[model samples]
Target chain A: MDCVLGIDGGGTKTVCIVMNAEKEILGRGETGASNYQSIGINAAFKSIELAIENAVIEALKTIKSLEVQVICLGLAGVNRPRDIEVIKKIVNDLQKSHRLPIMWELEQIIQPDNKSNNIIICHDALIALVGGICRDVGIVVAAGTGAIAYGRNHQGISKRVGGWGYILGDEGSAYQIAIAGMKAAIQAYDGRGELTSLVDVFTNHLQLETIEDLIEFVYRRGMGVKDIAAFATLVDSAAVDGDGVANEIIDDALGELVKATFTVIDAIFCPHIPNPSPQTIRNDDFEIVTTGSVWKGKSNIRERFIKVINQKYPYIKVILPRFEPAYGAGLLALKQYLQKSDSKAAH
Target chain B: MDCVLGIDGGGTKTVCIVMNAEKEILGRGETGASNYQSIGINAAFKSIELAIENAVIEALKTIKSLEVQVICLGLAGVNRPRDIEVIKKIVNDLQKSHRLPIMWELEQIIQPDNKSNNIIICHDALIALVGGICRDVGIVVAAGTGAIAYGRNHQGISKRVGGWGYILGDEGSAYQIAIAGMKAAIQAYDGRGELTSLVDVFTNHLQLETIEDLIEFVYRRGMGVKDIAAFATLVDSAAVDGDGVANEIIDDALGELVKATFTVIDAIFCPHIPNPSPQTIRNDDFEIVTTGSVWKGKSNIRERFIKVINQKYPYIKVILPRFEPAYGAGLLALKQYLQKSDSKAAH
Candidate 1:
């Protein structure tokens, strides 16, 4: 029986899954962060390797003769071409260093001898796109700690919008929303902006009495992006409780996200010329899959997002992911393996 | 002759001026940054002391026995009670360490020779207010690297709006405007925002082809608040060339500033309760003095700000500073010295 490996590496943690050719999940594993930018490349490599090993170990318990076929890694901080090359090299070196019993099995089942070729690497967002819609030709709006909109057409042509990070961009991100909420609270404290429940929420949440205490929290304590982003939940709760300022912040965030989604959708589907890519899929309908903490649960943001998109662009459909990013990566890897096998049979 | 000293200490440099009781400028001196938060307390003390010595040397060249009567320092980064105490101690320590021939003359001339009591400390904005209008009351709209509106009413009741710094607030500051322009340029580059000439302007200004190069400039080069604030000029130039996005950014900034100014004006002058302070100087008319680099020279931002304020708040008159912050500090010092002398004479 042939099994495939999928790994999703993010800034905070790494998750790995092992599955059969039929896409049945055999085993899963998780480890610390593998984002090379946050934790150095060596650390990222170690975390990814540990996650894969643990997943393989768990999968081997189920089947006696498990042949590993392909491996796909969907990782964060893989923006530039150099990042891809560096990560690919890390994986290649890991494969050479460790001759796992599963590697020997993989070597026997896969032909063309280059085991490294069996490994596929892509951005975490790409895998999320594939995982969300279970296809490559759609848009994925990922709004976690940060936010970005990415889309691809049938011809393999892709475009991205609004992933410039917290300082420069990330308009619809949790960080941005949380920052807006905090700013509103401070403004209210100073009597410069509208009064809101966020003042009490933030003061209590941060374990302080006054809204001005945030100044010390941010400046003196040196609160970082993730720490600040955590405040988005408080803002959401405040909005749910009918805080006008909180609602405005949510609406503003939704507006930015919708604007970004529109930009991506227009670029991919409604090009000035026919289709930009040669092998472009000429379909009028497209899915916009959203997968992030922000999209989870019953929130007005999600409802508003869907309503706005439906009203503005009727041809597009919004959805939650069919599977997680790791599963999507596994599907892509299986697809690649199948394509290679079919080409060999044709020859 | 008794000479009053006024010093303006900023993040970039320090300026000192010696003036007589009649407000005639005797001498001036300039030195490096004295903002304690940025350059440390010791360095701040050194810079301030050096500036005063230089000014005194210049003044002594004209007249002998130039006795120092009072000194006022308008400085940046001196927020909170602890900050005030720390800066006050720095000034007190400097006085103890240095005993110039000028100090001996001052000691001989002034009664009840407690020289430390002669020193007055205030935030840079306060000095700008006093300097702009040459009075203790009214409002000052300062839009330099950061932006803030501060007002003191006839009741001696004061209120402030904005100046929360780059991260939490500073809505209408040069830093904020520059950042908006940069974000717009990047968004335009990513096809996520409207096309603007800012893309080309930023490319040429930063000497890079793509907006992505800014990531390196900001993150790698460690561009700071003031560095980013400098880009406001580029944004202004782009706006002058009729970039719609740039114009919108400028207009948005002006709106925030005007809103903040209104908040300050309303809080100080339109109080429901009776005036709290004993030395209330009730008046119907008040001046709104504007200062800082953003207000200098020809810019639509200044014009729009003034026009909006005039239209909205007819009671508040907007005008440029009658004197620089240092000279304003001098005026304040002279006023305080005279008041103390009059009280003593009455006793």
Candidate 2:
């Protein structure tokens, strides 16, 4: 029985799934973080190996024998080309070591076939785009700890906007919203900005009495991006309770999201008049898929984003993902497997 | 024979000046940074002592046997009451040690007099206000690595707006401007924002090939507030050379500064109708003093700031400081000396 493995690796956790050739889910397993940048390559290797082992073990319970044909990993922190080479080497070393039972079993089962299997590695956003729309040609607007909009046309041309992290970009993300809320609260305390209920909300949430204490909490104590991003919910709740400052912040964030989405759509679909030599995709019919925690919440940012996008780009359809990113990775691996087999048969 | 010592201590350098009863500039000296928060309290004490000793030595060149009457220090990072007590104790210890010739000479000469001399420690804005306006009753709009608008009424009541550092506030400062410029460059590179000349400006300035290199430079390489703040001049130059994005950033910064200044002015000058019980300083006439490097540059931010303030608060007069903050500290010490002598004569 032919099977493929898909892995979604992030800074906090890793998920692995097994699927048959027909794309039916066989087993799923989760483990610790596999982001090599944060947890180091060795630990990331261990986490990925553990997740694959547990997933293979779970799959074996329902099947007599399984031959793993291909693997795809959608990982965070895979930005530069150097990162791909580094992660590929780590995965190759893991395959050669054959330390885990799943790897050894797969090696024995696939030895007679003499067919070279493949391992695909890509940025997490790629899997998100595929999983969100379950296709290759659409846009994915992800707003979590950071934000980015990735779009692909039918011609295989891809474009991205605003994945510059918390410092440089991430304009419509949870981190930006939380940071704006914190700044507003501090401005209110300094009597330089409009007063908001966020002052009390943040003070109680962070267990701080005065807004001045936030100085030490943020700068001195060193809060991480995700830790700060967690406060976006409080800002959303405050906005829901009719705080004008919080509402403005949410509105600004939605505006940024709409602008970013529009930029991605224009870059991928629209061709410039003066310099039209770049083989533009020129597809008007595509979906704008939304993902990440920001979309899951009750905040009207998504509604406003859809409203603006619909008004501006009527051909673009807004949607929520049908499957998780891990499944999307599996689908990508299956697509790659079919493509490779079809090319071999054609030759 | 009586002289007053005034010290202005900052993160980068410290300045001290000596003024006699007639307010003559007897001597001036400079030394290293004395901000205790960054460079330990002991080092701060040593810097302060060295500056004072150098000033006295220079004064001795013109006059003989100078009796130091009062000392006033306007130091950076002197925020809370605890900071005041800590700095005061350091000053007292330095006085007790009398390690320098100036301290010993002044101690021996003033020992016979039973009158208690004074040492006043205050935030740098207070001295900037005094030195800028040649008096205490006015507003000081300081834009440096950070921005703050501080105002003092005739009744000794003072209030400050902004100065929450680079992250939470400092909206109109060089750091904010540079960050905004960098963000615009990245946004343009990502095709999410307007194309601007800042992309080439930052790429060449930071010795980077692409704008994406800024991610590693800012996040991985640990670029600091001052280092990033240094790029503000480049943004200014880019704006002057007709960069639309840079011009927009400058305009936004000017708008923030105008709003902050207006807030400080309203809080200090305008009395609330419902809660009028607080002792209101009913002075309609006061100068708005401008200081810091932002005012020195040719950028229209300052001109726009002045224009906006003039249009809104027509009664408030805006002017540049007449002297440096160190000379203002000397004036403050001289004022304290005269007031003490007047009370002694009355008794």
Candidate 3:
């Protein structure tokens, strides 16, 4: 039976899903971090290989025989033609190493062949957009530890805003929010800003006795981005519990996210006019997929995000992901494979 | 002759000044970085030893013989009692290793011993404050690659604001300014923000064909904080050339610096009120010495900072550093050594 594999590779983990021609998920697999930037290319690929092998092993229990004719990978840091080329080399290496349950010759989907041309490689945001809306077109607002606003129009035009990472940008990201919270706490401690309960919140959450210990904890202890980002939950909880500073911080973060979303929308969807007023730029109804852990916070960030979006574009809809990103990748691969096969049959 | 040594150790390099009881510069030396946070303790101490050796070697040319009364070291990351303990062990190690050009036994300046108790270790900010206005009192608004606002009242009460590093705070720092400039360029490129010449500025400065190359340069290729902070000069130049976006970034940066200065002033110099209004908090005429490369920008950051600060506290006079930080450290050591000697003689 014809099968397809979809993979979503990230810094923390790699998730894979196996689907049949009928779009039924046959198997699922997960493995450790596959971010080539953080982990070396070999380790990252090893995780992908292990995930694929595990997923195929599970699929074998259900189907008598399976042929993975298509595979789509949505990975982080897969920007630029050079990045795609690097991924292609790794895929070629995987095929040459013969580290698969089923034999499949991989190639770009454009060069259709029965024995080849069955792979699609793209960035993580694309899969999130596709998975969230269950389609290839629309915007995806991803605000986990890092934040990015990305979208693809019907004409296949794509645009992105704010994904500059924790240092330069990531304005609405959990990392930024957490940093703002910590800054507010420090400021309050220093008598530099408005008094806030975040001083207590950070102290208790981190099991610290005084806010001054934060310098030792934050710098001396060598806290990673993820570790810092984890504090966003505290900020959210504080905001929900009515801490004025935390609420303002969240408000500012959401505003930045909305701005990034609006920028993406204007780029790919709005009319191409230099400095066109929002009233001058007309847009059709569109569903924007909101993904990542930030949405799940108790601060009503999603509700606030939707409210603000509606204020700007009442026709636009904000939603949670309808499917996993791996599933979306699988769907994309399956559609491409079926479309090419049908076209060949017609010819 | 009773001489004193003042060493300023930082991330980039270490500077040492040898001074006499007459407050005359006997010798000067410069060496590699001694920031133990960046380089290891051994290497940092080695740098300090080399700078001190060189300075003392030059001082020998000026004097027949020298009795070193005291030495004060101002280094980065010398915070907390624990950090001081760690530095003390290293000082012991440096002394035990017998690495000095002259056999000078060291101890804390408080011990008041001839053969020992001659070293005083403090944070880099204190040296900058003393060095800038050539005093133990008054505030120092430092806006280098990183920034911090630190002040000591006449009564020796000290307070600080900002200096939270690149990720947390560093509001008015060159790193922050460069980051803001880059963010603006990216926003302008994405059509999310107003169009600015910063896009061209970054591209030209970085020798890239397009602004998108920044993504490749920033993320793909590793760029350090100092390298990014170097772009602050470009932002300053742009602001000087009348770029509205760059001007706004500079204005915001200066405003944050002013706020930090006010915060420090309020904490140390102003009356201890829970929330004293500006009118209620009258401060004595104290010069806030402005140090760091950011002040040298063509954008008139220093001028703008002065203007904003005067608007709030007219008595808060802003001035450039009157002396180098190492000289200030020497001055501090000289004063402490003289005060202790005079007290012992009186007894």
Candidate 4:
């Protein structure tokens, strides 16, 4: 069976899946973070290699032999040409040392930097777009620990807003939500802001004896941006329980996400129409997929987003992902391979 | 010579000043940070002890025998009762171990739990207020790496706003300004925000070859909040050079500071006047002092702050610090000592 390897790697973990050309997922494996920028090139390569080997081993249990065609790695923090080149070199080294039967054309392996479409290296945004919409082009609002609005037009032109991390951006992210919640609690405690349930919510949830202990709890080494982002759920729950401040926070988060999404849409999807109003730019052809933990909140955040987005861009629809990004990578590889084969057949 | 010891301890450094009852400065000393929450209690104690020892040693060169009547310590993160108790215990141990000629009256030394007015332990806000106003009562806006608006009435009731640190608050702080500059530059680079000089300014000033390199520059180990706050000077410079975005950011920051200041004033100073409009609060009796490096910017931030604040509270005068915080601590101790002597004579 001819299959391709699709790997999705980020700051925390890596997942690689084996899929046949027909888009059926055969086997999957997981490993620690494979971001070269964070874990170093060698460690990242080892993680990718380990995941690939385990995935291949898992697939072998059913298939007698498998011919691996291509590998697509959609990774985070890979935005520039230099980053792509570095990841390509790592892939070149991986094929040389690994036991997988990678059927790279002879000349391509000899000269790794040459133009070979077999290996695809790109940013996580591409995988997110393809995976979220289950197609090549659309928009995605990712509101996890960090937030970003990304969109790719059919012409392959992509635009992104936000994603500047906790300090600079993450406007609609869980991190921002959590920060706003904490700030409101602190301000209310100082007798400067309106009273909110977040004060008691954070205090009770964090198991803090007093609200002042929150300072020590946050500045301590163990609690990082992700851990802080986790507290955003409590704010969402408070909003669900009819807390005024928490509801306002959720509304603000939605407003920011919607604004960012509109920016992306205007840049890529509606460039021909000058000064397209939010109500007029009704893009029906592409779906707006909402990803990350913020959408999974107990509050009607997702429903509210859909209602507001649809009311503004009446033709557009908001959705959840049909498949994971690793599977999307496999589908993308098969797509490119088939496209190339069709062009060759026409010739 | 009848003198008192006053120490101002913070996250970066500690300062100790020795002054006589007549408010004559005799000697001064400096040491590293003495925040026990950040650096352990032992290290904080040693720093304080070293600063006090150096000051007393320097003062002994002029006076035959220095009798330290009282001691006042205004330290950061010393807010709760537990924190004050811990600092008081540290002070007690220091007097027992060192040679400061502390006149504890035989009771405070044997049973340290007793209420002896000789040692004063307080939050940094009190020292800032006393030092900034050169008296015991007023509001002081401290906008350094962190921002806080604090005010105390003559009746001794104090109120604070902000000062929640980089993650939670720091509304008008240098850190927030720097983060805003970084965000604007990144947004402009992504074509999602207005083009501004901040992009080129941050890129060239930071020595970054590409804007994307800023991610590594920021998230990499060595760049903490203070280092990030240092970049705020560039934004101020850009505003000075007529960058619209930078100017707007400055205006927004000033607005937040003014808002926090009003909150502090309303809490402590304006309790009798409910719903007093910002324009109607013409407080001529007390000064509103502004401190920290943000006031040192060439962008006329301090001047603009004064203009806006004075416009709102017509009769309220804003002024710079009349003395350093450590010196202010000495003045506070001397004032208390003289007041105590007057009360004893009345008795």
For model 3 the interface RMSD, in Å, equals 1.5
lDDT of 2: 0.82
lDDT (tens digit, per residue) of candidate 1 on B62-137: 9786777778888875767788788778766765755444652223334455444577788788888988898988
Weakest 10 consecutive residues, lDDT, candidate 2 chain A?
A103-112
What's the DockQ of model 4? 0.54
TM-score of 3: 0.93
The A-chain TM-scores of all the candidates are 0.89, 0.90, 0.92, 0.92
Clashing pairs in 3: B107-B117, B107-B118
Who is ahead in lDDT, 1 or 4? 4
Q: Give the clash count for each candidate.
A: 0, 0, 2, 0
Comparing 2 with 3 on DockQ, the higher-scoring candidate is 3
> How does residue A164 of candidate 4 score in lDDT?
75
Candidate 1: give the clashing pairs. Answer: none
Query: What is the overall TM-score of model 2 with all chains considered together?
Result: 0.83
DockQ per candidate, 2 decimals = 0.58, 0.57, 0.65, 0.54
Q: What docking grade does candidate 4 earn? A: medium
Docking class of 1: medium
lDDT, candidates in the order shown: 0.80, 0.82, 0.84, 0.84
| Whole-model lDDT, model 4 | 0.84
**Could you list the CA RMSD of all candidates, in the order they appear?**
5.3, 5.6, 3.2, 3.6
List model 1 lDDT by residue over A1-347, tens digit each. 77788889998889888888787888887899998876788998888888877877788887776666788889875766778888878776666656344653334444456445677888788889988898888999998889999888777888888877888898989999899999999899778888888889999989986776677788677788899888789888888888999989888888888988878866867676443332232345568998676665245788889999877665567898899888888888888778767887998
Least accurate 10 contiguous residues by lDDT in model 3 chain B: B105-114
Q: Indicate the worst ten consecutive residues by lDDT in candidate 3 chain A.
A: A105-114
State the lDDT at B180 in candidate 3.
92
